[model samples]
Target chain A: MTSPRRVTPEPFVWLMFSAGGVVAALILPVLLVLFGVAIPLGWVEAPDHAHLLAVLRHPLTRLALFGVCALALVHAAHRLRFTVEHTFRLGRYDPAIATVTYGAAAAGAAAAAYLLLTAFG
Target chain B: MISPLEARYYRRRMPLLWWAHRRSYAIFVLRELSSAFVALFIVELLLLVRATARGPAAYESFLDTMAHPAMIVLNLIALAFVLLHAITFANLTPRAMIVRLRGRRVPSRVVLAGVYAGWLLVTAFLAWLLVAA
Candidate 1:
């Protein structure tokens, strides 16, 4: 009888990386323009406190926000992992580097979830 | 400790600044660096959410902080990096994905055009939702 093949987590990580990259590429530019530039600089009408709060309180908004934050961080982590490894010649410490990068991303995602789910409401 | 057989081949170590030596290499490095800015933007967003949750006063303060000259400059830099990330990712999507239609391979330019169309539609929808609505 053939033994069952063992699966690695690499594919799952790459899946998150791709999803995160696509989402960030598509959605983040407009958000950055609105929040960072237009609204802050008074180039566009800013959402009032109550209006903004109401939007954040919506379930769909919270979910979308959480997703964007979590996935973007994962995408960043994956890219930074290889970039740092190759640029700095840290191949010997690959395991440690991977842990630190992915760990930070996971922590950031958890923080996002907490803020979105509890703090916002 | 080098063995006789291994010593026959010359191994040249890559310079740490090799990316700086070529324009394409430099752009590649910059593209990689964009990920750091992406993370920074997410952190800022999380802070924004946290401030809003704290109350109206805190949210006002957050906006005040964002409006500061230094913060504006930093965000502008971030906006540049984000654009780089977005554009490069969009351009590369056609190469990375293989879309099939009716058992025939889809041309790359068609796929790229579709991606750009989707991006435009998404941006337009978001603009309407955030600004008009």
Candidate 2:
């Protein structure tokens, strides 16, 4: 008998795409209505916060953007270091994995700041 | 099984196999990693924008929140982190997109040009919004 197929180990980067997907999905319809209807008809300002409200009010929208941002940050941090290590062969040159690890953490923190501080403010 | 020269040759040859087999994994890692910085920078700017546009009380609220020492530290760290992320991403983009011209590897200068151009376009657009508003 054939052995059962093994699943690929987790791929985390897709989580960022997923988060981006949710934001786009929730925001897109409001954007379409604004551009397709309200803007042309002189109803919505580009700076209007109505759509922001639509997003904030929806539990699903809030969860996706915030949750995705957090998960994606960690995923991106891990992936970025991995890529840098291989691309530059920094392992051979830099001889310090801490630089890569700390750098990834820093990048991920920046992203988290953007979402939390700015989006919420 | 034996010669020092043969081992040397194999070691040099290994990078090709490593790159070919692991290229996607590498790319994914780079893209995701850059996203972290972009995400934070985006959120911070958005917050400041919303607060400023809302008027004095809101702006005061922003100051109120920023009064927290923790936030100041976070922002400083984010700024440094974003700088690192942006520099790395711009250098990596040509390969990330697999951009090539006429089957020759495009020069790094050309990729850098595209990155700067993109930065200018974004800055100009945001400037226009500020001026118009």
Candidate 3:
């Protein structure tokens, strides 16, 4: 006889964590070096104010950035959740820990969406 | 009375600084901590977008704030952590994924090389878009 199917949120959470990890690894470094270090240090010419604003106005740019921010946040949440659990031996408080970590990620993602889609426009 | 199995077993209490006891453990902890840096970078990006949305003057001020010595130093540290995150994550990708090409399985080394190559290509394109374009 076939076993009954079980549904759980664990796999979907893991999928988000994995996708976020890949996106953060591939895209974040260059963006960080340019905006965080090079331009601010005056090693590279900063993109002009009008040019930056124009770029931000583009729907595609906003959408791509939103994807990056939201995914990265979720990735961070997943890792932080486990790290806190193991490092502190807080396994008994798993439910509370998961709620806090994932809640923050969701809130951050919502903020990113609001900023990108509505506030910017 | 305790069961014979329970009485026979010994459970060692884990120390609070278990991760600090070994070099590899320390590195593993640092790798885990890198996620916080990733989150910090995203928060910075969101603030940047918000500043831009506010207007040119606010954007310029945001840039000034970012250029502050303290902010610059913080970003530098964050950069180091984020790079660690990227490199560690990329290296682990091969073990997590098994790719097959036709009838042959792709070697882990080949998969790793492909990942690094993609990283470089993406970085180059973004650099051109942001700096050269």
Candidate 4:
């Protein structure tokens, strides 16, 4: 008797993407507005270097930043993977495309974790 | 029976600039491109963390680099794109999530409001933390 093929573990990947999307939506705009526009345009005084450094030095802040960075990378990887595949009609190379995108995200998250840990530890 | 000639249909190839032809498509493409900016910001933060690891002088130097005019312009552009990304993503949340209460489907506007409310609370908390510090 022929056996049915196992379903791929795609939902977990999608869950990561969804979580990242929520996190990015909640936080990124605020960060960008503050650091990118308000400070640069003089609408608000930029946080002094010492103060900003102190915040980053905080353990909780480091963890939060690391979480955002890692998850956002996964989110971007998933989006870019689909965007490239659809735009270029590369559906035939799905496995290679997924590997490259997710691999890059994993590497980025690893780098972020290493930097966050060593920099503050 | 249908003739082969009658069954055949022409397929118009999607143009390179197809996204440009419609405002919605352009916005979508820009939204996807915004992820690159998000990645850049992550790299920038990593560098910041690295600088902090090196101590005050390195961190100050990093701030100096960030204060440069070119970096400011790039950051402003990034801010615009990222804001667009966030808004579009937030608007899509209601569709992606199906909330239910007491066996009835929750309204989409309610879901959207909840998402934005959460965003507002988080932003307020961050702002308060920054100001208080």
- Steric overlap count per candidate: 0, 12, 0, 0
Candidates' C-alpha lDDT: 0.90, 0.49, 0.91, 0.81
Q: What DockQ does predicted model 1 obtain? A: 0.75
Q: Runs in model 2 with CA error above 4 Å?
A: A1-121, B1-56, B67-73, B102-105, B130-133
- The lDDT, on a scale of 0 to 1, for candidate 1 is 0.90
Question: Candidate 4, residues A1-76: lDDT per residue as tens digits?
Answer: 9799888768888898888877877887777777665765667776666677678888899899889988999998
Instruction: Report how far residue B94 has shifted in candidate 4, in Å.
Output: 1.6
Q: Which stretches of candidate 1 lie over 4 Å from their true place?
A: A1-6, B1-4, B7-10
lDDT of 4 by residue, B43-105 (tens): 776887788778878877876787789988998888887777789889998899899999999
User: TM-score, each model?
Assistant: 0.93, 0.39, 0.94, 0.86
The TM-score, computed over Cα atoms with residue i paired to residue i, of candidate 1 is 0.93
Ordering by DockQ = 3, 1, 4, 2
Proportion of native contacts in model 2? 0.08
The model with the greater TM-score, 2 or 4, is 4
Per-prediction DockQ, in order? Answer: 0.75, 0.09, 0.82, 0.55
> How many Å off is the CA of B108 in candidate 2?
2.9
Task: Specify the poorest-scoring 10-residue window by lDDT in model 3 chain A.
Answer: A46-55
| DockQ for candidate 3 | 0.82
For residues A22-113, write the lDDT of model 2, one tens digit per residue.
33222322322332233334444434343434444355644544554444444444455556666556656433654565465556555544
The residue-by-residue lDDT of candidate 3 on B23-60, one tens digit each, is: 99999999999999999999998998998889888888
Residue A38 lDDT, candidate 4, scale 0-100: 71
Using DockQ as the measure, the top candidate is 3
How do the residues A25-71 of candidate 3 rate in per-residue lDDT, one tens digit apiece?
99999988988899899999988777778888889888899899889
